[model samples]
Target: MLRELEKAEQKWGGSNKLIDQWLENRRKLLVHYCQIAGLPPYTNAEKSLPSFEHVKSFCDLLVDYVSEGHFEVYDQVINACEKFGAPCKAAIQQVLPKITPTTNAALDFNDKYAETQDDQVLYQLDKDLSELAHTMETRFELEDKLLEVLHSKYSEHAQQA
Candidate 1:
Protein backbone atom coordinates (compact mmCIF):
# COMPACT_ATOMS: atom_id res chain seq x y z
CA MET A 1 0.00 0.00 0.00
CA LEU A 2 2.84 2.34 0.87
CA ARG A 3 4.56 1.54 -2.41
CA GLU A 4 1.35 2.19 -4.33
CA LEU A 5 0.90 5.46 -2.52
CA GLU A 6 4.46 6.44 -3.37
CA LYS A 7 3.79 5.77 -7.01
CA ALA A 8 0.62 7.81 -6.87
CA GLU A 9 2.45 10.68 -5.23
CA GLN A 10 5.17 10.54 -7.84
CA LYS A 11 2.85 10.17 -10.78
CA TRP A 12 -0.14 12.38 -9.94
CA GLY A 13 0.76 13.84 -6.60
CA GLY A 14 -1.95 13.92 -3.87
CA SER A 15 -4.02 16.34 -5.90
CA ASN A 16 -6.35 13.55 -6.88
CA LYS A 17 -9.68 13.52 -5.05
CA LEU A 18 -9.42 9.76 -4.75
CA ILE A 19 -6.22 10.06 -2.76
CA ASP A 20 -7.81 12.62 -0.45
CA GLN A 21 -10.72 10.29 0.29
CA TRP A 22 -8.29 7.44 0.92
CA LEU A 23 -6.30 9.60 3.31
CA GLU A 24 -9.43 10.53 5.23
CA ASN A 25 -10.46 6.89 5.48
CA ARG A 26 -7.03 5.99 6.79
CA ARG A 27 -7.33 8.68 9.45
CA LYS A 28 -10.70 7.36 10.55
CA LEU A 29 -9.31 3.84 10.71
CA LEU A 30 -6.45 4.99 12.88
CA VAL A 31 -8.78 6.70 15.32
CA HIS A 32 -11.14 3.74 15.48
CA TYR A 33 -8.29 1.32 16.06
CA CYS A 34 -6.87 3.49 18.79
CA GLN A 35 -10.18 3.64 20.59
CA ILE A 36 -10.70 -0.09 20.38
CA ALA A 37 -7.17 -0.78 21.66
CA GLY A 38 -7.85 0.84 25.01
CA LEU A 39 -4.71 2.92 24.79
CA PRO A 40 -4.38 6.07 26.91
CA PRO A 41 -7.41 7.28 28.89
CA TYR A 42 -9.34 4.39 27.44
CA THR A 43 -6.90 2.08 29.25
CA ASN A 44 -7.78 0.92 32.74
CA ALA A 45 -5.20 -0.98 34.78
CA GLU A 46 -7.88 -2.73 36.80
CA LYS A 47 -9.32 -4.18 33.60
CA SER A 48 -8.59 -7.83 32.85
CA LEU A 49 -4.97 -8.32 31.89
CA PRO A 50 -5.73 -10.78 29.11
CA SER A 51 -8.16 -8.40 27.47
CA PHE A 52 -5.82 -5.48 27.82
CA GLU A 53 -2.99 -7.49 26.30
CA HIS A 54 -5.18 -8.33 23.37
CA VAL A 55 -6.01 -4.68 22.95
CA LYS A 56 -2.33 -3.85 23.23
CA SER A 57 -1.57 -6.31 20.49
CA PHE A 58 -4.30 -4.76 18.38
CA CYS A 59 -2.92 -1.33 19.06
CA ASP A 60 0.56 -2.47 18.05
CA LEU A 61 -0.73 -3.70 14.74
CA LEU A 62 -2.63 -0.46 14.29
CA VAL A 63 0.41 1.65 15.07
CA ASP A 64 2.38 -0.23 12.47
CA TYR A 65 -0.40 -0.15 9.93
CA VAL A 66 -1.38 3.45 10.43
CA SER A 67 2.18 4.62 10.60
CA GLU A 68 2.70 3.36 7.09
CA GLY A 69 -0.59 4.87 6.01
CA HIS A 70 0.41 8.22 7.47
CA PHE A 71 3.76 8.13 5.72
CA GLU A 72 2.09 7.60 2.39
CA VAL A 73 -0.48 10.31 2.98
CA TYR A 74 2.18 12.78 4.05
CA ASP A 75 4.32 12.01 1.06
CA GLN A 76 1.38 12.50 -1.27
CA VAL A 77 0.32 15.72 0.41
CA ILE A 78 3.79 17.17 0.10
CA ASN A 79 3.99 16.13 -3.50
CA ALA A 80 0.57 17.60 -4.20
CA CYS A 81 1.52 20.92 -2.67
CA GLU A 82 4.64 21.01 -4.79
CA LYS A 83 2.84 20.08 -7.97
CA PHE A 84 -0.33 22.11 -7.50
CA GLY A 85 1.45 25.29 -6.59
CA ALA A 86 -0.78 26.39 -3.74
CA PRO A 87 -0.80 30.07 -2.88
CA CYS A 88 0.79 29.09 0.43
CA LYS A 89 3.36 26.89 -1.24
CA ALA A 90 6.20 28.74 0.35
CA ALA A 91 4.78 28.10 3.82
CA ILE A 92 4.27 24.41 3.15
CA GLN A 93 7.77 24.14 1.66
CA GLN A 94 9.29 25.71 4.74
CA VAL A 95 7.50 23.25 7.04
CA LEU A 96 8.42 20.04 5.18
CA PRO A 97 11.82 19.56 6.82
CA LYS A 98 10.67 20.22 10.38
CA ILE A 99 7.55 18.08 10.14
CA THR A 100 9.04 14.96 8.57
CA PRO A 101 11.79 14.35 11.12
CA THR A 102 9.53 14.89 14.11
CA THR A 103 6.91 12.47 12.85
CA ASN A 104 9.53 9.87 11.93
CA ALA A 105 11.23 10.05 15.34
CA ALA A 106 7.97 9.60 17.20
CA LEU A 107 6.95 6.66 15.03
CA ASP A 108 10.36 5.02 15.51
CA PHE A 109 10.25 5.34 19.28
CA ASN A 110 6.71 4.01 19.47
CA ASP A 111 7.56 1.02 17.28
CA LYS A 112 10.46 0.04 19.51
CA TYR A 113 8.60 0.39 22.77
CA ALA A 114 5.57 -1.51 21.50
CA GLU A 115 7.37 -4.85 21.68
CA THR A 116 7.49 -4.93 25.47
CA GLN A 117 4.81 -6.94 27.30
CA ASP A 118 5.58 -5.58 30.72
CA ASP A 119 2.55 -3.82 32.17
CA GLN A 120 4.42 -0.86 33.56
CA VAL A 121 6.36 -0.39 30.37
CA LEU A 122 3.34 -0.94 28.19
CA TYR A 123 1.28 1.53 30.14
CA GLN A 124 3.95 4.17 29.93
CA LEU A 125 4.42 3.53 26.26
CA ASP A 126 0.68 3.61 25.76
CA LYS A 127 0.44 7.01 27.38
CA ASP A 128 3.14 8.41 25.18
CA LEU A 129 1.91 6.68 22.06
CA SER A 130 -1.62 7.87 22.63
CA GLU A 131 -0.41 11.43 22.87
CA LEU A 132 1.60 10.98 19.73
CA ALA A 133 -1.40 9.54 17.90
CA HIS A 134 -3.53 12.46 19.01
CA THR A 135 -0.95 14.82 17.65
CA MET A 136 -0.87 12.92 14.39
CA GLU A 137 -4.64 13.03 14.15
CA THR A 138 -4.64 16.75 14.69
CA ARG A 139 -1.91 17.24 12.15
CA PHE A 140 -3.81 15.32 9.51
CA GLU A 141 -6.99 17.21 10.25
CA LEU A 142 -5.20 20.51 9.94
CA GLU A 143 -3.61 19.44 6.68
CA ASP A 144 -7.00 18.52 5.31
CA LYS A 145 -8.28 21.95 6.20
CA LEU A 146 -5.32 23.51 4.45
CA LEU A 147 -6.07 21.42 1.39
CA GLU A 148 -9.64 22.63 1.40
CA VAL A 149 -8.50 26.21 1.52
CA LEU A 150 -6.01 25.66 -1.22
CA HIS A 151 -8.54 23.92 -3.42
CA SER A 152 -11.01 26.76 -3.07
CA LYS A 153 -8.37 29.32 -3.88
CA TYR A 154 -7.23 27.34 -6.88
CA SER A 155 -10.80 26.98 -8.10
CA GLU A 156 -11.29 30.74 -7.92
CA HIS A 157 -8.04 31.30 -9.79
CA ALA A 158 -9.11 28.84 -12.45
CA GLN A 159 -12.40 30.69 -12.91
CA GLN A 160 -10.52 33.97 -13.27
CA ALA A 161 -8.10 32.49 -15.78
Candidate 2:
Protein backbone atom coordinates (compact mmCIF):
# COMPACT_ATOMS: atom_id res chain seq x y z
CA MET A 1 0.00 0.00 0.00
CA LEU A 2 2.82 2.37 0.83
CA ARG A 3 4.46 1.59 -2.46
CA GLU A 4 1.22 2.28 -4.31
CA LEU A 5 0.82 5.49 -2.39
CA GLU A 6 4.32 6.57 -3.39
CA LYS A 7 3.54 5.86 -7.01
CA ALA A 8 0.38 7.91 -6.71
CA GLU A 9 2.39 10.77 -5.31
CA GLN A 10 4.78 10.60 -8.23
CA LYS A 11 1.92 10.64 -10.70
CA TRP A 12 -0.11 13.27 -8.88
CA GLY A 13 1.47 16.33 -10.51
CA GLY A 14 0.89 14.93 -13.96
CA SER A 15 -2.81 14.08 -13.51
CA ASN A 16 -4.91 15.56 -10.75
CA LYS A 17 -7.98 13.46 -11.46
CA LEU A 18 -5.91 10.28 -11.29
CA ILE A 19 -4.39 11.46 -8.07
CA ASP A 20 -7.82 12.19 -6.62
CA GLN A 21 -8.99 8.72 -7.55
CA TRP A 22 -5.90 7.22 -6.00
CA LEU A 23 -6.51 9.16 -2.82
CA GLU A 24 -10.11 8.00 -2.63
CA ASN A 25 -8.91 4.46 -3.17
CA ARG A 26 -6.40 4.92 -0.42
CA ARG A 27 -9.15 6.02 1.96
CA LYS A 28 -11.19 3.01 1.04
CA LEU A 29 -8.22 0.74 1.55
CA LEU A 30 -7.73 2.25 4.98
CA VAL A 31 -11.38 1.69 5.83
CA HIS A 32 -11.17 -1.89 4.59
CA TYR A 33 -8.06 -2.59 6.57
CA CYS A 34 -9.67 -1.15 9.65
CA GLN A 35 -12.65 -3.44 9.24
CA ILE A 36 -10.54 -6.51 8.43
CA ALA A 37 -8.40 -5.92 11.48
CA GLY A 38 -11.57 -5.80 13.58
CA LEU A 39 -10.69 -2.30 14.57
CA PRO A 40 -13.33 0.38 14.81
CA PRO A 41 -13.44 3.15 12.26
CA TYR A 42 -12.44 6.75 12.99
CA THR A 43 -15.84 7.37 14.58
CA ASN A 44 -15.00 5.04 17.45
CA ALA A 45 -12.97 7.61 19.30
CA GLU A 46 -13.53 5.99 22.70
CA LYS A 47 -11.85 2.74 21.74
CA SER A 48 -8.38 4.02 22.43
CA LEU A 49 -6.67 0.78 23.44
CA PRO A 50 -6.67 -2.49 21.61
CA SER A 51 -6.75 -5.94 23.14
CA PHE A 52 -4.94 -7.77 20.37
CA GLU A 53 -1.52 -7.47 18.77
CA HIS A 54 -3.16 -7.39 15.36
CA VAL A 55 -4.93 -4.19 16.27
CA LYS A 56 -1.67 -2.65 17.35
CA SER A 57 -0.07 -3.75 14.10
CA PHE A 58 -2.89 -2.21 12.13
CA CYS A 59 -2.48 1.06 13.99
CA ASP A 60 1.22 0.97 13.25
CA LEU A 61 0.47 0.48 9.58
CA LEU A 62 -1.83 3.50 9.60
CA VAL A 63 0.79 5.59 11.36
CA ASP A 64 3.36 4.58 8.77
CA TYR A 65 0.98 5.23 5.90
CA VAL A 66 0.20 8.67 7.23
CA SER A 67 3.75 9.69 8.07
CA GLU A 68 5.58 8.84 4.84
CA GLY A 69 5.56 11.11 1.82
CA HIS A 70 2.42 9.52 0.59
CA PHE A 71 2.18 12.95 -0.92
CA GLU A 72 -0.87 11.83 -2.87
CA VAL A 73 -2.62 11.58 0.44
CA TYR A 74 -2.21 15.31 0.86
CA ASP A 75 -5.36 16.07 -1.07
CA GLN A 76 -7.41 13.68 1.01
CA VAL A 77 -5.90 15.10 4.15
CA ILE A 78 -6.86 18.61 3.05
CA ASN A 79 -10.34 17.45 2.12
CA ALA A 80 -10.85 15.93 5.54
CA CYS A 81 -9.65 19.16 7.08
CA GLU A 82 -12.24 21.04 5.09
CA LYS A 83 -15.05 18.60 5.85
CA PHE A 84 -14.41 18.47 9.58
CA GLY A 85 -13.78 22.18 9.92
CA ALA A 86 -17.34 23.05 10.89
CA PRO A 87 -17.69 20.64 13.77
CA CYS A 88 -14.29 21.73 15.00
CA LYS A 89 -15.22 25.40 14.71
CA ALA A 90 -18.65 24.82 16.18
CA ALA A 91 -16.90 23.41 19.19
CA ILE A 92 -15.33 26.85 19.59
CA GLN A 93 -17.36 29.11 17.32
CA GLN A 94 -18.38 32.47 18.79
CA VAL A 95 -21.35 32.95 16.49
CA LEU A 96 -24.83 31.37 16.78
CA PRO A 97 -24.02 30.20 20.33
CA LYS A 98 -20.91 29.88 22.38
CA ILE A 99 -19.62 26.33 22.72
CA THR A 100 -17.83 24.81 25.64
CA PRO A 101 -14.06 24.64 25.61
CA THR A 102 -12.99 21.05 25.39
CA THR A 103 -9.52 20.31 26.62
CA ASN A 104 -6.94 19.47 23.96
CA ALA A 105 -4.06 20.40 26.21
CA ALA A 106 -3.05 16.78 26.65
CA LEU A 107 -3.03 16.31 22.91
CA ASP A 108 -0.02 18.56 22.60
CA PHE A 109 1.88 16.41 25.03
CA ASN A 110 1.74 13.29 22.87
CA ASP A 111 5.08 12.37 21.17
CA LYS A 112 6.57 15.75 22.11
CA TYR A 113 10.04 14.24 22.12
CA ALA A 114 9.77 13.93 18.35
CA GLU A 115 10.52 17.62 17.97
CA THR A 116 13.89 17.37 19.76
CA GLN A 117 16.70 19.07 17.88
CA ASP A 118 19.18 16.33 18.51
CA ASP A 119 20.85 14.48 15.67
CA GLN A 120 19.02 11.43 14.38
CA VAL A 121 20.67 8.06 15.04
CA LEU A 122 19.98 4.70 13.32
CA TYR A 123 17.77 3.17 16.03
CA GLN A 124 16.06 6.50 16.58
CA LEU A 125 14.96 6.75 12.96
CA ASP A 126 11.91 4.49 13.34
CA LYS A 127 10.90 6.22 16.56
CA ASP A 128 11.32 9.51 14.77
CA LEU A 129 8.83 8.41 12.10
CA SER A 130 6.23 7.56 14.72
CA GLU A 131 6.80 10.91 16.36
CA LEU A 132 6.56 12.60 13.00
CA ALA A 133 3.19 10.92 12.46
CA HIS A 134 2.00 12.28 15.77
CA THR A 135 3.18 15.73 14.81
CA MET A 136 1.46 15.50 11.44
CA GLU A 137 -1.79 14.50 13.09
CA THR A 138 -1.53 17.49 15.38
CA ARG A 139 -0.90 19.80 12.43
CA PHE A 140 -3.90 18.44 10.54
CA GLU A 141 -6.15 19.07 13.52
CA LEU A 142 -5.11 22.72 13.71
CA GLU A 143 -5.42 23.20 9.96
CA ASP A 144 -8.94 21.82 10.12
CA LYS A 145 -9.84 24.54 12.59
CA LEU A 146 -8.46 27.22 10.32
CA LEU A 147 -10.24 25.86 7.25
CA GLU A 148 -13.54 25.72 9.11
CA VAL A 149 -13.29 29.36 10.07
CA LEU A 150 -12.30 30.46 6.58
CA HIS A 151 -15.14 28.49 4.97
CA SER A 152 -17.80 29.46 7.49
CA LYS A 153 -16.87 33.13 7.25
CA TYR A 154 -16.75 33.21 3.47
CA SER A 155 -20.35 34.25 2.88
CA GLU A 156 -20.56 36.97 5.52
CA HIS A 157 -17.18 38.44 4.62
CA ALA A 158 -18.08 38.40 0.95
CA GLN A 159 -21.34 40.25 1.59
CA GLN A 160 -19.57 42.90 3.64
CA ALA A 161 -16.73 43.40 1.17
Residue pairs in candidate 2 whose N, alpha carbon or C atoms collide under 3 angstroms? none
lDDT tens digits by residue: candidate 2, 7-59: 44454424345445545554554553544333444334553332334333444
Query: Can you tell me which runs of candidate 1 are displaced by over 4 Å?
Result: 1-18, 36-46, 49-79, 82-87
Give per-residue CA lDDT, model 1, range 1-161, as digits (tens): 33333443454346667565555455444554445545454565665433445545554655554465457655655665665565556655655554555466555655655455666655555456566666655554445454554565566668988
Candidate 2: Cα lDDT at 54 = 34
Report lDDT (Cα) of residue 16, candidate 1. 67
State the TM-score for model 1.
0.55
Strongest candidate by lDDT? 1
